[model samples]
Target: MENLEKAIAEIKQALPGLTLLEQEPLAAHCSFRIGGPARALAVPQDVSSLARICSILKEHQLAPFLLGNGTNILFPDEGLQELFLISTEKLQKLFLLPDGAIYAEAGVSLSRLASFAQQNGLQGLEFASGIPGSVGGGVFINAGAYGGELKDVIESVVCLYAPDQGLYELSKEQCAFSYRKSYFSTHGGCMILSAVFRLQPGDREEIAAKMRELNEKRRAKQPLELPSAGSTFKRPEGHFAGALIEQAGLKGFTVGGAQVSEKHAGFVVNVGGATSHDVYDLMLHVRKTVYENSGVVLEPEVIILAPDYKLEDKGPRVHGNIVTVNGPAEE
Candidate 1:
């Protein structure tokens, strides 16, 4: 707490132009519209500014909790008083290289990135047109839908290694992408700066048509009208989570404001006034019932943020005011 206080003071003096929100409401910033005030949320305009903020936090022995579009995370209603947050909201630099690869900052929404690709007559990213996450978050979780993931197109990633205060560009293979997981997600201490995507050239109208088709399918099946994270649980090996959940008779199950979506069994929607605890309890119940019925354990896809309410399978997580970045989580 003392170190966070010191870092906060130093950051104010060092980067006056940066937008620093002290005790900012997390609900106002996330898609789920949940969570209480964060201790501090810093929005950097570009990569260098973000790096500078990380540096200051690291000096204080703090590790920042990186927030993207907040589509796949659950924050506690009690608020994160000791955590320092870094938002990729303003890191919006995106363009194409002369060699035809697309370069994007962490903050670029996946939908926008897909649209940009379609506009340039690029194919392959059509499946991402409906995913509601930024490039950084998408890359972090290898966000996928309709048979496509960010990993399929991403060629490289440039990130800030917090431990050394240096930058490293990792190749696609080095990223070690897999089913909703990545090097960045499993390994801590590295902050994604930007990424390069390689795509195949295709007819513009054809690309747009494919994107439209995928988005239409997504809208028809998923609960776009509700406030919720995308998927509540990862697909248990060889079995679909939604099907298993529905077969367990948990369809439309509710705990307070949180309910399993009747529209799609995979999603847990906030009908209204849902607290983080509401979602958490509902998920726990779902996990319990589903396991009891199906003999398959479900793992939460949503990143729950609360010291006391951590999932049993939780790994190296950075809580508190000290922002430590990639140490050994690096490789």
Candidate 2:
């Protein structure tokens, strides 16, 4: 406790405008609303502040986790310890360039980007209308949805990296984007500052109509009424996670407060007061039962940031291009 407080104080001196909170609840930040309190959390007001805070944490050997919209993570019940949570919620800056390009800051949400594109008569980004995450997080995980992915529109990304010194620009090809992966994820030391996307001119009404169509589909098919970390697992080769769960007859399966969504068998929703352990246990059960029943194994799509009660069976994750993972397009 004393160490965390001292860290917070030191961070405040380094970053004046940024706000620091001790023992901040992770559940409040996550969409699932399941995680326990973090040791400390810092919300930087802008890019400069964020960089400064990062530098401070690194200097103190207290490297923290970068938290975005919290749409794709499940924190543990015992909570994170001796770690700092840095939020970019306040760094939202969206603008249109004179060269028909859209420059968006990392903190901007996909939903916001979709709206901006539609309003400006931009044809692309229609598939990302309902993706609930920030640009950095989306790009970090290569978020995609409705047949469109981030690599489709992203021309280049400007990142704050300290390989030599300060931030630098990396082209689309340099990003090394792949199926739900990126260079920033592979090679550390790069913090996404912003991105420039090339968009085609189109009718505003047409773009709006497309956005509405996708949003409607998401509402109808997904369990929007419940809280979940999007899809529970990635689509394995020649198989779908939802279908596997359904075939296993584990739809609506419950573990404590966590229950698989009957609306969409792929999702494990928090019906009421679900704990992190409950969700983790249920996920493990789904993987075990599905593998036992069938030859295929399921891999988790949602990232876990805390310790689990038991270790997940570690083996080769089923990988191939036999299926598509539906998600919001990346920036």
Candidate 3:
């Protein structure tokens, strides 16, 4: 409460254009449609506002979570403590740069990027045509689909380093992209603002055809109609995590409103009004059971945020056998 007030005051003083919300529900911000409330939510409209918000958070000693489209996160049902939720959803901007490059802000959605690329006869981004995350979020996690990743297209990224100065730029190499990680995920000094993507000119019809094919694949393989994070867990080495879970006979396993998608064992969908805890417990069960049966510890792809539990110790408790169920089974 004290920190919230302090943060609000500092933000008002520094960035007058910023909007702040109190006790904002996480369900409204996440794709999972669950979570209690954030201490405060701040939406910065521009680069200057974002920098000032960052400075205010730093001054108030509060670490705000940098949220994107909230397409891949699961918020806690118990809610978060005193923290600010910084949203870049409105910072959307795009430009067709010379030399066949696409420039986009962090808030720009992948769908928009894909559309723009297609319209401009650009190739190499059709794989991300249906990805639900923002460009910044995509870059933060090296988001990928259909054998392509943001890393492959991203030439450089511009980030704000308020702790040091105003803005900084990092090349793709500097981004330190791995499977599902980047420098931003590891080191916390920078926040992505915009990025430059190098694309090649291709036939528009071909790009559209490719996009259509990928979308069809998703429609067939993934449960796109459900409220769920796309993938529940990362692909463990030597085997598909989903195959293992399905083989363990855990598909359609429900905990409250959350269910391991029968269509795709990899996804945990909110069949109804599933709470964060329900999904969390289900993921834990899947990881533990998979490890016990096959000795492969599954890692979740979805990021969980809850006030009561830290990310470090919230996963993997029961493993040996199925225990007493907590939530109701899906019909």
lDDT of each: 0.86, 0.80, 0.81
By lDDT, the best candidate is 1
- Residue ranges of candidate 2 with Cα displaced over 4 Å: 1-6, 162-165, 307-331
Worst 10 residues of 1 by lDDT: 317-326
Off by over 4 Å in 3: 13-16, 310-331
Question: Considering summed lDDT, which 10 consecutive residues are worst modelled in model 2?
Answer: 321-330
lDDT sort, best first: 1, 3, 2
lDDT by residue (tens digit), candidate 2, 168-222: 8889999999877788765655778899888889999999989999999999999
* Clashing pairs for predicted structure model 3, backbone only: 256-327
lDDT of 1 by residue, 149-257 (tens): 8899999999898878889999999999998888887788778989999999999999998988888888899999999998988887999999999999999999899
Q: TM-score of each candidate? A: 0.94, 0.90, 0.91
Which digits, one per residue and each the tens of the lDDT, describe model 3 over residues 101-197?
Answer: 9999999999899999999999999999999999988998899998999999999999986456467789999999988778876566567899999
Better of 1 and 3 by TM-score: 1
How far residue 140's Cα lies from its native spot in candidate 1, in Å, is: 0.4
Candidate 3 vs. true structure, TM-score: 0.91
TM for candidate 1 is 0.94
